[model samples]
Structures are given as structure tokens and as C-alpha cells.
Target chain A: MTAKTTDRDRDWAAALAAANAGDARAYARFLHAVMPVLRGVIRARGRSFGPDQQEDILQEVLLAIHAKRHTWDPAAPVAPWLYAIARYKVVDAFRRRGAAVHLPIEDFAEGLAAPEADPTAARDSAALIGQLDPRSAEIVRAVSLAGESTAEVGARMEMSEGAVRVALHRAIQRMARFAKGERG
Target chain B: MRTEDLIAELAASGPAAPALTPRGTGLRMLAAVALAAGLFLMLAGTRADLAARLAEPLILTKTLLPAMLAAIALPLGLRMMRPGARIGRAALWFALPASLAVLLWAATFARTAPAVRFADVTAFALSECVGLIIAIAALPMVFALRLMRAGAATRPRLAGALTGLGIAGLAATGYSLFCTQDNPLFYLTWYGAAIAAVSAAAAALGARWLAF
Candidate 1:
């Protein structure tokens, strides 16, 4: 693009080289640089899922990206790699509390197998459900899991957006409670 | 605000990009040719001044070439061979220059050292091989910062790191031909350590160059 853009590109290339070679400080710089993208993915997806816990998903995604970066080949463009990371984080959000298709036991099990199964995830999910009032869980399932947009879910549930928003908010709270295995 | 401005703002608010990737068998062949030329220069120079004459091409390749090449080329070549591992778009625009700066660092090492000898044309390359590796590793951190500021996005940190290491390894071979003196340990340890430090700094900085 502009000369400044070109210069930036060149420098980015160098940072990657350093980080790949195993520089902690360089990796930190790398992390700082990309925080915006992480935030974007979280915010964009959070609008639908409710922003209450978007930051949590973003953190998970970052950890995953950091932990699993060695598999990437150098010759390829990094966008797809990042997209893949974001996609997983978004899916994780859906699974945790957002509107998501409650997969059959077998299907969910299979999904769990692909990313090292965390016995604690299921435990956490159950715990979050415990804290939520019954009404909240139903709203969460319908809005976050049942593939219904907030408006659509609201209309189907015969409630105003305000009501839907309130219910969803409570449901997300329960989900967060489950995730942390804490009522607080 | 206008929709365009909102979109721009949103886009700017997103994670940075990290562009990374490589070439073909013919290109590999070209590298091989370059390696050969570099080797010739290095070996010729190493032998140019031995009273006892440790400068033998076959020996050089056996002891220094393979280790140096493995240390450098295997990583770089594999990256060339496997392009799918990186998430290239995540790097910031400024990062590109930052990497250039790192790569450029290798060239500076080529300047005449304390002992510029006739054989240095060849033997000196040993040092260069190590230097190049240092440059490759160091480039990404600086590159990423520059790219992030310029607004490039990146992800897949491991990919960037591997590629950086691989590139450093390859460049090191060429560099080793020029920089390596009679001491193998010196190149492996001292030079290697220096390179590692610089590379670590580069990557740490480059991480920012990529989008999250």
C-alpha cells in the first residue's frame, strides 16, 4: 500500500523470524500486536452470544494459538491459521454458553476427542447449569444453542427484546458459573 | 459516524496479520547452487593459508557442511516444502521491514573482521552461517512490531517461530562458510548464543506484528 505500510510489512516479517527462533520478549511483542484481532473476533461473536463473557473466549483462543503454533508451516499465509483459531474459539463459546446445537452424545464425544478432552469441561458445564435458575438455562439453549438469532428467539419465545435480553443475560451468567464451577 | 468509518474502525480494532510462507524443487536447486558457490568460496579461502593446511573441501563438507547445513537448511527447506503450517495473513505491515532489518543484519557480519585473510573468502563463511541463523530468528520480532503498526494481522505463532528458525538455519550455512574460522565450537556456542538472543528479541517483537 503506502510506503509506511510497506515498511511495516517488512518489520513484521522480521519479528516473526525472531519469535519463531524462540525469543520470549519477541513473542510478547507479537502478542501485544495481535490483541486487537483477538478482541475483534471476541466482540463480533460476542454481540450474538452476549458480551458478558467474550473476553473469556478470547483468552482461551490466545492460549490455544500459543500452545499449538508449532504445527504451522512457514511457507503458507497466516490468515487461514488465525481464522482457524478464531473459529475454534467461537465454537468453544457456543459450546460453553452461546446458542449452539446440542450435539448428540456421540457427536459431542467425537468433537471432544479432536481437541484433547478436558474432563473438567463437562464438569464445569454442569456446575454452571446448577447456578442458573431453570428459566435461564432454557433461554440459553434456545438463543445460544438452538440456532436462533436474538430477535428470532425473542419472537418465538413470545417475548420482547428486553425480556429476551434479560433472560439471555441470566442464562449466560449461569453458563459462566458452570465454566468456573463457582456460584459466585 | 459513517458506515465506512465504522468499518474502518472495526477493521483497525481487529487482530493484526502475520504473513509467512516458500517455493519449489527448482528453487531448491537454486539454493543448492548457491550453497555450492558459497561452499567453494569458503573452502578455497580456508585452505588459502594453512602452513599445515587444514583447508580441505571434502573435510570441510564432512565436518562443517553437514552440521551447519542440518543446523540451518533442514529447517528452512522443510518450511519451503511445507507451506501449510503458517498463518501468514496475521502479521502487521510494519513487521515486513522488521524482518528485512534482521536479514540485513547478516550482511553486516560479512564486513572484514579483525583477521581478514585470503582464505576468509571461504573459511569466514562458517561465521556467516551462524550469523544468518541469528538474523532469521531475530527478524520476526522486529518485523512484527513494524507490521502491527502498519496494520497487518497475524496468527499462528508457532508457524512463525518455526519458519524463523528454519530460515536462520539455512542462512547460517551460507554465513558459516564466510564467518566460521577454524573453530567449530566458537561458531556453535558463541555465535549461536548471540544469534539466539537476537532472534528471541526479534520474535518477541514480531509477535505483535501479527494479528491476534
Candidate 2:
């Protein structure tokens, strides 16, 4: 690997290790840092997808990374672990749409420097939230869409911050399940 | 929702528990084997001459073949649990024990007189052997699938098949102790059939359960 790639992997690995140790800021930083790489890879692979469809796939990748984070070994390099999930989600999106595509592993390395952009519009994931219980839907929307902190949402909902976090985690997990075509 | 918003939500969800290590997977697999052993002993004790028979090369081969298969498949199945991890050369390793068994079967079949070859193959309790092997495998297959589900398997069907193959190998090992049928012609056909059935079932189930 290149020196730059080594540095990026080291940073991501450390951040993810800290994130797993309960540092939310580190986790956020890790997610932000990886977003451009993930976006670039997704865009390159799913060129036929509209902007919204691409975002939907990106959101699915993000949710999968969250839900399956426990599958990543701390001692291993973060890039492969991260990109594996990205590739799986991208391939899954293609399969769901009745298309078959073969993505070369090297494609991910080239897309690492691609620019990140906001989704043109909310789509599948936005609709998935409505399937959550009313309280969970509110908690997810308040925290994600309105940019409210867990503490703020907890206070407004008369729940503990810890409870809010648990609820949000469960809600996100359910959304992941829903996205994968699982029923309640 | 915007990508940034999704990132915020995931970040706030807090850290996940540590990934399940290879050692953890090994321990769970051992526990499943223990459970299968318990079931095997309860339902069908070892053959009367098992202690003496174990010293015989043919008797030992029956047990060792599946045992070896399980040993190799455990790591391969664990690799399948990871999203992008390639099983690489470990997958090719399966051919070692597999070819050994097939060659042994072919040699044994050829040496037997053609007239009696059919009798030798059908001499055992075919239904009982197949049923017992599957029965021994059933619970362990569930445990293996559960463990597979806990990880992010990108190739769910393949992961499931590997797990099933491993579990069936263990189950077959246990069944070998109870099975007195020493003929390679008999054990090879029925045992192979049972393992294939289990693998296929797991592959179908994994496609549905391990998708995430």
C-alpha cells in the first residue's frame, strides 16, 4: 500500500477503536472521514443509479456499517473491513433492482479521493423510518433529520439519554432489517 | 435524509461491542459438538467393539475423514462471516480429505466382486444411517447458523454451506463411533448424501437469515 493509504488506514483504525470504546466524537469523525471514500466507490459502481438511488444505497451502506460494526476486528486494517460492507451493499442494491454487476476490488482504491456531496432528496431510508414505532420514529427523526442530540431528544421525550441512545440504536437496527426485506 | 444526517445518527448510536474473535467462534463450535455428542450418546451408544475397532485403519479412517473436514472448514466458515474477506486457499484445502474419501470408496468398490458390490452397499440400515446423521446435525446447524448471523456475511449462502459442512462433519464423527458399518461402500454413499443434504439446507436458510 502507498504511504498515504497506510496513514489513512491507521487514522481510521484508531478512530474506530476509540469509537467502539464509547467515544461518540471519534465515531462521528470516523464516519465523516470515510463518507467521501464510500460515496466515490458507490458512485463509480452504481453509475446508472439516479442521485436519490445512489444516496439510498449510501444510507444502506452506512446502516450496515453501524449494524455490523461488531464483525470488524480491531487489529485488522479498517479500509478492507469498511469497503467490504460498501461493496456488499452496492451489490445488493444492484441485485434488488434486477441487475447483475461484478465490481473489481481495485475500483475502491481509486475512489478514495472522490468528493462527498449531499443527497438530492430523501428516499427509501426516509420512508423506512415511518415503519418504526411512533416514539422510535420521533427519536430517529429528531436526532437524524433535525440534528438534535440524544440528550436534547431525551429531555423532550421525558426519557434518559441512555434510553434514547438505546432506542435510537434499536430503531436504526430495525431500519437496517427493513431495508434488507425483513419483517417485524 | 442527507448523508451527513445519517452519519450523525449512526455516530450517536454509540459504540458496538467487540467483534467476535476466531477463538470465540471455535469455542462455540466446540460447545455445539459437545451438545451433539450428548445427543449421540443418549440416542445411540457407541458400537460394542468401538474401543477395539478404533485401532483398525478402516474404522479409524471413517472417523478421521470427517474430523479432518471439520478442522479445515471451521476457519473457512469463520472467514465467510466477514463481509469482504476471501476464503482464498483455505477453500481449496477441502479437497484433501474429500479426495481421500472418494478414492478410498472407489478403490473399495472396484475390488469387491461386481456381483456382490450392490449387496455390500445396500447391506446397512440406509434410512437409519442417514436419519441419525441428520438428527445429530440438526441442533448444531442451528447454533452454527446463529453464529454466522451474528457476523456480517457478504456471501450468506456460502457461509451457511461452510457452517453446515463443518457441523455435519462433526455430527458424522460422532455417528462413526456408533456406526458399525465398516464397509466404505456403505458409509461413503450414505454419509456423503447426509452431508450434502445438510449443506444444501443451510445454504437455503443462510440466504434468508444471514443476508444482513
Candidate topping TM-score: 2
lDDT tens per residue, model 2, B1-212: 57888788889986696666767876888788778877787777889978899999988999999889888877788788887878887778988998998899999988988877667455348887888899889888988888777888998998888888888888989899898888888888888899889989988998999998
Interface RMSD per candidate (angstroms)? 11.7, 1.3
Candidate 2: clashing residue pairs, number: 0
Give the interface RMSD of candidate 2. 1.3
* Second chain alone, TM-score for each candidate: 0.38, 0.94
lDDT per residue (tens digit) for residues B75-96 in model 1 = 4323322212333443343254
Q: Model 1, residue A45: what's the lDDT? A: 64
What's the residue-level lDDT of B71 in candidate 2?
86
> Per-model C-alpha lDDT, please?
0.47, 0.81
Give each prediction's DockQ, rounded to 2 decimals: 0.02, 0.54
Q: Tens digits of per-residue lDDT for model 2 on A70-183? A: 788887899999998999888887776322111111222233433233231134555677788999989877865565777789899999976987797688777767767898
lDDT of 1 by residue, A66-90 (tens): 5445434454444555566667556
Q: What stretches of model 1 exceed 4 Å from their correct place?
A: A1-83, A87-184, B1-21, B24-156
